[model samples]
Structures are given as C-alpha cells and as structure tokens.
Target: MNTLSSIDYIIFVLYFVLVASYGYYVFKKKKAQEHDSKAFFLAEGSLTWWAIGASLIASNISAEQFIGMSGEGFFVGTAVAAYEWIAAIALIIIAVWFMPVYLKNRIFTMPQFLKTRYNDSVALIMAIFWLFLYILVNLTSILYLGATAITGLVGDATAGTPEFQNILHLIMIGLAVFALIITLGGMKVIGYTDVIQVAVLIIGGLATTYLALTIVGDKLGVGNSAIAGFKALMNDSPEHFKMILPRPAATTGTINTPLNLDIQKWVVLPGIAMYFAGQWIVNLNYWGCNQYITQRALGADLKTARTGLIFAGMLKLMMPVIVMLPGIAAFVLHKHNALPGFSGSKDGAYSAILSFLPSGLKGLSIAALTAAIVASLAGKLNSISTIFTLDIFSKYIAKEKADEKKLVITGRYTVLVASILAILFTWNDLLGIGSEGGFTFIQKYTGFISPGVFAMFLLGMFWKRTTGTAAIVGVVLGFVLAIFFNNYAVGIFGKETWLYTAYTYETLGKDGLAHATTEIPFLINMGWSFVITVATMIGISLAGPKINPKAFMTDKALLKLDNRTIAMIVITLILLSALYVKFW
Candidate 1:
C-alpha cells in the first residue's frame, strides 16, 4: 500500500466521483415520456449518428479488450489485431445488407425478428439462452476481470479482506451504480454517457502510447529508436512474436509445418476462414440482429444509421493502434525482466504497462483503465436489462400494453435485478477458476451461447426453409457443439491426440507439448460450431417440411438499397488490404 502514492489515490477518487456525477446527470435528463418496450430498449429510435457511433465504440472496446486483447498482442504480436480488422468487414456487410431489413421491419429485439421469421418458440428459446449467457458469461466475467484488475492496480486498499469477499463487494458496488444509471434512463442515457466514455478511452489510450514511446525513445536515444526497439523485440524472439507459431497435429503426433508458409496464415486467416465461413454469420446476428447493441443504430434515421455504422467501422480501424501497439511498445520498452511474474519467455505487455507507469501519470493511467472497465460494465448492464425486459418479461409475465413511462420503470427494475445476479456471479470467481490465463473463462462461456444464438438468427433471416423445429434443433446443436469443442474436444481430446503430441515435441522440443497450446482453441471450436449448426439446419430443413419463403423475405425488404452499403464494402476491403500489408 505504501508503494501507491497519494497522487494515485487522489486520481482514482476524483475519477470515481466524476463518473458517478455523470451517471446521475444522465439519469436526471432522461425524458419522462411513456417508457414502453420501444423506449426502454431502443431509446424510442431517437439517436443521431454521433451518439450512435460513440456508443458503439464505447460498448465494444472496454477493459477486456484493452487488458486481455492487448496482452494477447504483446504475447503474440499484431496478428491478434485481426479480430478488429475482420470485424470492419463484418460491420460493413451489416450496414449494407443487414441493417435495412432490421430497420424496415421496425424490430425491437433480434429475437423478435426470429419470432416473426421463424416462430414464437424460436424467439423464446433464443431469448432465454441470450439472457442466461449474458448473466453467466458476458456480464459476470467482464465484471470479475475489471474488478480484479482494479484491485490489482489499486493494491491493498481493498486487500486484507477475504479475496472473494472483496471482489464480490466491488462488483456489487459497480453493478449497483451501473443499474441505477440504466434504470433512470435507457438507451438515451447509455448513448450520452458513451460519447463521454469513448472520448476518455481514446485520449487515455493515446496518452499511454505517447508516454511509452517517449520513454522508449529516451532510453535508446534516437528518433527511430522506438521502431528499432520494437523490431528488435520481435526479431530477437521469432517464435514468440511471429504471427504464425507452430501447432501440434490433430492425429499424427506431428507438426503442422506447411500451415505456416505465409505469415498471413499465422495471423488470423484460418480464423478469418472460419469467420467469413462461420464467424461473420454469428457477428452479423450480433451487431445487426442483437437488440441491445443494435438498438443504438435502430434509433437513428436510415441515413444517420448508415453513417453511424460507417463511423464505427472507421473507429475500429484505429483499435489496433490503441490496443495492440501499446502492448508491443510495452514489451519493447520493458524487455523480459520488465515486470515481476512474467519474465520467463512470453512478453508481459500488460504487466509492463503497470511496471512502467511514472508517478503522476500512474494516477491518470489508472483512471483511464477504470473508465474503460466501467464503460464496459455500463453497456453490458444496460443491454442485459433491455433484453430481459423486452424479450422475456414483457412476453411471458407482463402482457399488458404498458405505456412508455411504465416500461421505463420496468427497465430500471430489470437492470437492478440483473445487476444483482451479475454481482453475485462475479463474487463466485468462476472467471479465475480455470487454468488458462486471465479472462479465458469469458471467451469460453461466450463461445457456448454466441455461436448457437448466431446460428439461430442467421438461418431465421436468410433461409425460408428454416422452420421453428429446425431452428430449435440448430440452436441446441450449436450450443452442444460449441460446448463440446470448447471444453471436451479442445481441452481433453485435442491434447491427447498423437498429432498434438508429435507437433508439440517437434516444435517445442520434448517439453514442447507442455508449452504449445492455444488459449482459445478458436480454430477448432469455432469451425466445429459453425459446421454442425449449418449442417443440422440444412439437413433438417430438407428432411422435414419446408417453410414459406414469403415469411422470411418480402419484395420491399429484399430490394431496398442505399449508397452507404457500397461505400462500406469498398472501405472495408481497402482496410483489410492495408492490415495485411502492415501486420503480415
């Protein structure tokens, strides 16, 4: 505790007070209009492009990304930034092809689209799965990680108490604050606060980056020293920094040597292959279909919506610079011995960030980190409440044609309840119970629901033959496959195979098998989830009865077009090419 200067404490307290005050202001300004399902979940379709764009960025980029993904970039290199670049393409596609349908239908929730396109049963199932996953996986795990990081950064102030007890207390406090904000106002509050959050996140990220560069530059004593140092770090440890590291075979007890021919191959191409082939299918279902996220765009007019989507896409282009570059810089500046507990071989970019913080800057940096975490918490809290209130409670328990005011009140209550559950779940420390590094639990749990939910909505949208029965089967199968692949197949089966053993031995030596493992098993599980879901849906649709195509598509909906779609596609392709050149 003595190591933490008073400056750090003051900065933290100031940040907390400012955020709390802002939340209160947002709550106070919320319109008192009838808060029906539409207003509660979708902000009564009143957002403009700027608010929509900022909210999207704030919601998407959070502590999980800054700490976890940046840690990945530090360990693996810029190749990890592929997720952002790839998403640029996905977002464009959604803007051009997907948004029109959603907007035209005036759908509030993605599940509602399912109900209309498939059947009520499909919608209900999806709603249940999404709600459960939100509480158990997304909301809880993120809160845990954010809370843990804050505790670590703040040190001892919240320590000495029982570990789990302190974490639970912190999470509950955070969640309660978040719930209060959302309850007072719905998407309007979220959007307004997001603009502020996004601004803070960018400024803070850039400040960190600039400080790191200056420190590195001064150490090496050259203008190009920072770049040289970065290159040296990568060059000196080829295996660690290389975009494509070796992997064990699935069956042969051999190395998959040929797969590493091209650097792009190692980066995210295989994952991208799964993505376009499968992952995008799910992401579209997320951005285009998911209510909580999409509600921002849905609030905009058509042109504003299109602009918002494009603006978000453009902002994503800067993500690697903010998240990945800092990690790389941290690794370069600090070297292997930079931070305690991360000295053996793997780069400790995240640890380095903490280690390298100077006195005054430390407080500001911690404040920024706190802001990122709180922003994520706020978005998830609002969205989870939105989905629960709109899709589940309104449909099943409360059938009244509630006015907007009543709906807003219900939304507030829902956020409170969800926040409580999330706080309780966070207290359990399920996030840290696993063997994988920090935040692995989040990725694993998300895999279970994300793939399946994605599958259900995608098929519901495109395939007229997809019946309620087929949807249920696809959703269930997707979930089962995602779990099996994520847990049993990758964790157990993948490790024991002769191929894995051989590859591990060859690439990493006799002990290679011990070190050579993926954190996410992304390639295997993601691929399996998609293939199984698509096959089951198609096979079942063919074997069983066919559904009316008219229900899924209409003349006006099918033929609609806007120039924004073309622009998005072009921009995405150009950006993808640029990423390949820079990282590969």
Candidate 2:
C-alpha cells in the first residue's frame, strides 16, 4: 500500500515539471531587475494582490502544518485548530493597522525596523537571534518532518529502520536542492510560483481529507461518504471534538502504573488559559512581525498590501479542514482497529490516512506535501539570506554603498549555506523533533523568543516614550522570565500558586519507562513573561521623554480603512465569529 503506482509517479513528475517550468518563466521575466535587493528579496512591486496572498499562505503552510498539525489533530483534536483560526483574526489586524505602519515606514526587514525605531545595537542583536531561530528551529523541523512524511508514502517503512533512515536522508537532500533552485531565482520566482504551489497544496490536501473521511465512514459500516465518515468520527471520538481542554486533575499515581493522559493533553493545550495567554502572542508576532511572513506584502503599496493580507486571512479559514481533519479521521480509524501495522505515533497519522488514497491520487497527495515543504523551505532560505545579506553583510561587512550584483550573489550563497546546515542538523534528528511532537516542538522553542520580540515591537510602535534602553532590557528580561516560568518556577514556588498551577504528567522516557515531570504550561509562561516585560519597559521609558526624538510621525489618514478593506474585514469577522461560536 505504501508503494506508488506508475500513474502516481507520472502525476508527481508532471507536477514537478509544471512548477519548475513556471518558476523559470518567472525568473527570466524578472531577470533584468533581479540584482536589485528589494526586487530579489521582496519581489518589489511585481506581485499582484493574489500572488502576494497565495505566497503568504504558501510560505506559512509547510510540513509543519501538514504533518505536525495533523499529528496534533490526532492527539488533541479540534483545539489544535486554534493556531490556524486565530491566525485569521491576526492577519486582519495586520492588514488594517500593521500593514499601514510597515508600508508608510518603508520597512523591508524586521531587524531594519528595530534599527529605525530603537537603535543599531538592538537591531544587530535581534538579527542574530532570528537567524539562529530560522535555521535551527523552523528550517530544521520542516526538513526533518517533511522527509519523514514523504518517506512513509514511498515504502512500507518502519521508524528507526536502516531503510527508513536512508530514504529520509535522500528526501531531505532532494527537498533542499529543489528549494535552492526556486530560492536562487529570488523573491519574484518564489511569489509567483507560490500561486501554483498553494493551488496544488489545497486541492491535493482536500482530496486526501475527503478520502480520509470516506475511509472512516466505510470502516464504521456506513457507505463511503465523507459526511458519514465525519459523523462517525464525531460519534466515535467525542472527546477529540472539543475546542477547549479541561484543566489537569491532581495526580496521585506513580509515573508508570497510572498515566495521566489528560494531564499530558492539558500540558500541551491548557484550555482558556492559552486563549488569554500565548495564543495572541503567537499569532500576532508570526503574522505581523516575522520576516518570513510579512515579507510577502512589504513590497506592495498600502492598498495592495492590505488587500493581499485580507485575502490570505480568508484562505486561512479553510486551512484546518485541509490539514487537521485527516488526523482526526485517522484517530477514529485507529481506535476501531482499522489501520493495520500503524505505529500509533501521532506524527504518523497523516501517512496512515494517505494509505486510503487511490494510485493516481496518491501521487497528487505527495505533490501537495512536496509543494508545502518546498515552498516553505524556499521562503525560509530567502528570509535567512535577506537577514544575513541586508542586515548583517550590508552593514558590517560591506560598510559602504554595496553593488546590487554582489548583494544578490551574497544572498544566493547564504541560501546554500543555510540549506546545508539545516540538512546536517536534521540528518540525525538532533533536535528531538519527533519526541516533542513537531507542532509542539516549534511552538515551545519559538515561545522563548516571542514574548521578547512581540513586546519590543508593540512598545516601540505605539509608545513613543519607549526608549532604546527599555527595548534592550525588555528583550533580555522577557527571555529570562520565560525561562524561569518554564523551567524553574514550579520547583521554586511549589505547584500551586495564585498566578498559575503547574501540572505533573508522566511521559515515556528514552529508557522506555514513564517519568513524571512538572511544569507550568508554556503559553501561560509566555503570557506572564509578556505582562512583566511590558511593565518593566513602561517604567523604564517613563524616565526618558514624553515622545522620543526618533518617534515616527503619524496621522489619522494612515489608519483609515477603505470601503473594500472594510467589506473584507466584516466578512472575515463574520466567518470567524461563527466558527468560534460553534466550536467554543
């Protein structure tokens, strides 16, 4: 069942050729302006509203969403959809408010924003942090998880087998090379080709989802119908359909004998607490502040940027259906003992669901997965290259008016170097992405920096009294508090506190024995960290000036919303409200 038919190979090959050919067409059309840094990195003004919108979604959805989020779906159910759902609202805010500021200020990169608002020191420090985070956490996980997912479809593979590991390496390298081809063509190529990539991603993903639901229905003795399969899932695994997880109950059992699986679930997603805490930070910082995402709209005029962002938000509404529902279906089937030889790893849920796909359709699904992985890889590599070439190299190494050709060449080299490093790190699973669950692993590590980065950006933009010193200190303090809350707070202050309660859960250790670990939920940690960091920053800034000398001039005109923008915003809100009302 894992093996692909000849028709499947033909479908996949055709897809590869179509994308490559289109990417080449885009590259050649823009070849004359490719040397311009803005054109190469941001695609400048070439991208239309639709291209920008599709590119935004393409860059954002990768192996992490397809595999990691689906894995989360298998384990935690609809609650995991919060990440995608909240992102819709976040994009709205960015379109209306954040996009105006960015476009008016002509900010091209995140570090550049820091340098303009605060000081050179703050900018330089963050540039380094972002570089490491992108390569180590974001890039590595995408490669490792994507390779793992595709390898599952290629053969009857078992985890930890020699054959499986060998296939994984080949897929990782192949993915890296494919991404490099797109990335070297620069941002125009990335943006335009992403239109096709997003199309394949959605179509193939929906095809897989439909089949998964039908399989579920057929397995439950109903006819092969997606609606029937969905009903069967809801009927069979009622607990998985909840939007919020309950708080962990007090545990009295030993580590191995009596497992608190509910507590483990709560640890990953801590109910209303997360809604009040890291949820906003995660969405806002990602959609508004991150270079990899915001770069899509940075090159456009104000109206175009706003429209593109709203378009992306609309697309986000359907993402959970494409990415998360299959895992839930897999859970229903696995619970019924319908999936033979399944390993029961949460990350394997997507692959197990793919077994239901017909021969030609199997190739289409793999193409979808490959599209997600390659688009994200190319996007991340471009961002890494942008930061290094523009933020670091332009300022430090060149220290003069650099030539456009040299800058473009430097950016390409950075992409190659970053891809190699990511592949090397992911080769051995050195980051333990598999153990932590891919979705949770990304959120946890990224949480360490989000509190600080979001705090800095928020205070810098709105609060003119916020000084450079406050910005620097806030960044450090946010990180420190996040670490304290995550690692040491429970041990120092006992499990129960007025602020938050730490929960104890047993997880299987490397020795194949359960071990009890106690910790405050990470989202709660991020929330408290943000609150305290903002307070400290405010106090420090109060001593500076009522309005800092470098404060950006603003006018009512900048925040004004057009009729079209307003219409889109209203539609997005209506859809978003209905979703939460039903799920909540």
Candidate 3:
C-alpha cells in the first residue's frame, strides 16, 4: 500500500538532482558576486520576464495554498478559490500601477521603500515589524503547515493525532534545514531554480488533477475516462463549485449572550465581501507590495518587471485549476463516495487525494508538493536575509559602514538565525494552535497588517500629499483594527458578528436582539479591516504635516509601458470580471 514505488523514488531522486545541481550551478555562477551586495541580493539586475514570473508563482504558492485551499474546499466548498481569484486582479493592478514606481526607486525591501518615501523612523519601525512578522507569522506558519502537508502526503501521519504532532516537529526541522541550504546559495540561485520548481509543481499538479478525474470516472463505472470522471464529480458535488457565498448565519443566540430567538447565524463564509472587498486587501498587499514575492520581480527593469508581473497574473488565473480544482475534485470523490478514504476533515482532503497517484507519478507529484514547500521557504528566508542585511544590519547595526562582502556575509548568517527562530516557533505552535483551519489561520493573522500595508502603499504611490507621520499612524491603525476585530469582536460588540463587527443595530442596548452568531470568516474580517485602515490613512494624511511629494518620485521618469503590458492587464481584467460574474 505504499504510495510511492522504487520507480517513483528514482524519479524523485532525479528531480532532486536536477533542482539541486541546477541551483548549485547558479550559486557557483554568482560566486564572483558574493562580495557585491547589489549583485548578490538582486541577481545583478539581470532577471528576465520568465524568471521573474516563475519565481513569483514559485514563491507565492506553497503548501499553505496547495494543501490549505483544497482543505477549505473539502469543508466549505470552492469558495476558497477566492484567494487565487483576488490575487489575479491584484497582480494585474500592481503591474500596471505599482511596478513602475518601485522600479524607479530601486528599493531592496518594502521597508526601504517606506523609509525613503516617508522617513527613517517609519522605515526603521517597519523593518523591525517586517522581520518580526516574517519570522513569527510568515516563516513559522509556512514551516508548520508545509511540514504538516509533507507528513500527511508522504506517510501515515494522520492529522490531529499525537503521533502526527510529534512528526510535525521533525518535519519542520527537515524542511527548515532544506530551505536554509538552498537559500544560502542566495537570490540568484533561487531566481533561476524557481523556473524548474514552478514547472514541476504545475506538471505534477496537472497530473494529479488528471489522475484524480480518471480514477473517479472509473470508480463511477465510466471506463476510466477523465472527462466522464469530471462529469460524474460535477453531478455528485455541484454545490462545491460555488464561488459566490451567501451571508453566514447560524440558528439562534449570539455567543456569550443569551436570549431565545427565532433565528441565529454565523458566517462560515462572508459572501459579497469576499469578492468585492475582503480578498482584495490580502491580494493587493501580497502581490503589490510583499517583500519576497515582489523581490522576485525586482532587479529587472520596468518593462521586464511589468511583463513578469502580468505573466505572474496569468499564472494566478490558472492556479485555481492546479490548486483549487483538486480540492473540488477531492470533494466530489470523497463527499458522497467512500473511495478516497479521507475522513471529512478540512486539511486532509489534498493528502487523501494523494492516495490515487498510482505508482510512478507519486514521486513526481510528491516532488511537486515538496517543491511548493521548499521553494516558498527558500524565498521567504532570502527575503528575511535581505531585510535584515539591508534594512537592519546596514542601517542600524553597522550604520552602512560595512562593505559589500561584510553585508553579504551578514545576509548568509541571517538565514541561519531566522530559520532557527522560525523552527522554534513552529515547535511551539505544534503543541496546539486553534482549529480555524490552515487557510483561515493564515488569513486571520495576515489581516493584522495586510490592510494597513496595502493602504499605505497604495496611497503613498498615488496621493501626493500623504505625510510620513500620517503613514506611521495609518500602519498603527491597521494593527489596532485587526486586533479588535479578531480577538475582541464579541466583547466590544456585545455579541459575535462577522463583518461590521463594531456595527450596531436599532436597539436601546447592545444585547442579543437578532440572534447568536459565530466567529467571522477571516476573509470578511480582512475586508472590514481594510476599510478602517484606508479611512484611518486618509484621515491622518489630511490632518497635518505631510512629507514633500518629491521624496517618492524626485527624478524618476514617467514609465511608458509596451503593448504586451497593456494586453496582459486587459486580459487579466477580462478574466477576473468574468469569474465573479459567472460565479456570482
């Protein structure tokens, strides 16, 4: 009953060789630049559109999405695909509106851009926050989630069990070490190696999708046809295909408050807010301004960056097929049928589908999943190094007195320090994190800052009068809003409510009038949080001492994008609009 065979192991080994050797060669090529900080950190400004595009996708789509999104699909339906949908539009927006300014500024980290555009204080605080968030939330969560996925897919570590919990720590260590080894080679190696990583992920993901369909088809007595299987799945779980969710409600009584009511509701999924608003905050911040993912698009010129971003957008459009479809497919196969043998759990759907990969392809498919984890880990580690070296070490610790070689060396050591910290955090998290589910867990924490980050970046670029002082306040406001919404909603609002957490109804006192409710879905939480962040930023910006506009764009020339860029955005918009309409 082994999922992988000897042949599968051979394929996995060969893939490992191909990726490791190629990464090694790239690292060796950059050996001469190890002493040159810019060259080492930014690939000597030489990445092409294809490399940038591939690295963007490779770094962005990890086990979190691969495993978590599908898990959500199993539990909540295709509504989880909204993450990818939001990202597609966000990518297009970034390419057309944001990349030009970033290329002109030539910033290394997101905090650096903030520093130059705002002030040293703004940048410094953000640098420290970025490092903290990267290590604590981004890296640790990825490690835990990625390790959890590997344990489930590759072995018999059933989730939520004590045995699996122990294995999670070991897997975290393994994935952390593996990422550190790759990241030590620096950005050049990763920028190129990601091409192969993305290719493997897509090929393997497609293979799994095809195989799942065929297996379902045969299981349904359709003669092992993928088309027949897909149709059968459609027939079996049509409800799982819904993209637009309705208002979330549970029957009778708000949390902690008691009154007999006719109806009670909690939003399992926040419907309209997810599409028009909530998901956008996550996407815009992630695609437009995230340090590591955007770092992949850096180094290249504006044209290449634009092309690459658009290309990444196209890839984003396709991700639902590779990542989300499998979850939906798994739902169809497992929901009504017992064949896939997965317990109806949120996180196990993707791992359960791994049971159908047959013999030879299991290695390739597992390699793909592994690629998602390792590539994403390497990218985050590299970003952490870049931020630490350029933002923290050079700026505060060394005061820019350090030379190229010293900075590069600091970058290398930083990879070790950050990984150890992330590993430690993952170990701690293994004891018990709440069961918000993986996808929800990631977004819930992310909502803490994504909205504020997006608002600052967006306004900083377009609004001429936004002050650095205002920017600082805006960022602080975002964290405050998220803290209130996520942890204090029930306390502050007098009862649990999803969106409009601070909302009030026409009542004398804030008691349980309508009904009881559940915790808000994370996406809707993000959406409402974004609104507060935006409002705070605008209010603060209009209130007082605005920084000089020239700081953001003193001498940079206006960008003239080529037709390819225009076409890319247009097509992205068309597809994005089409989806909401079709699914709405």
Go through the candidates in order and give each one's C-alpha lDDT: 0.63, 0.91, 0.75
Candidate 3 residue 190 Cα shift, in angstroms, is 0.5
Off by over 4 Å in 1: 2-27, 34-36, 157-172, 175-179, 217-282, 333-335, 340-351, 399-403, 431-434, 487-520, 543-550, 555-569
How would you encode candidate 2's per-residue C-alpha lDDT over 1-584 as one tens digit per residue?
Answer: 25799999999999999999999999888878978888999988889999999999999999999999999899889999999989989999888878877888899999999999999999999999999999999999999999999998895667788888988899899999999999999999999999999999999999999999999999899879999988888888888888888775766335534247677778788898899999999999999989999998999998899899999999999999999999999888898899997878999999989977899999999999999999999999999999999999999999686899999999999999999999999999999999988998899999999998999998888888899999999998999999999999988998989888888877778898977788788999999999999999999999998999877777669788889989999998899889888777
- In candidate 3, position 89 carries an lDDT of 73
Clashing pairs in 2: none
Residue-pair clashes per candidate: 11, 0, 11
TM-score, every prediction: 0.83, 0.98, 0.90
Q: Quote model 2's TM-score.
A: 0.98
Give the Å error, residue 340, model 1: 4.8
lDDT of 3: 0.75
Task: Give a tens-digit lDDT track for model 1, residues 116-190.
Answer: 777778888887877887777777666665665555555454333676456546654764575456445667777
Ranking by lDDT: 2, 3, 1
**lDDT tens string, model 3, 356-475?**
778878888888888988899999999889988998889789954999889989999999999998887778575233244666667777778887787888888888778887788878
Ranked by TM-score, top first: 2, 3, 1
Q: Highest TM-score: which candidate?
A: 2
The true-versus-predicted C-alpha distance at residue 400 of model 1, in Å, is: 4.6
Model 2 poorest 10 in a row by lDDT:
250-259
TM-score head-to-head 1 vs 3, winner: 3
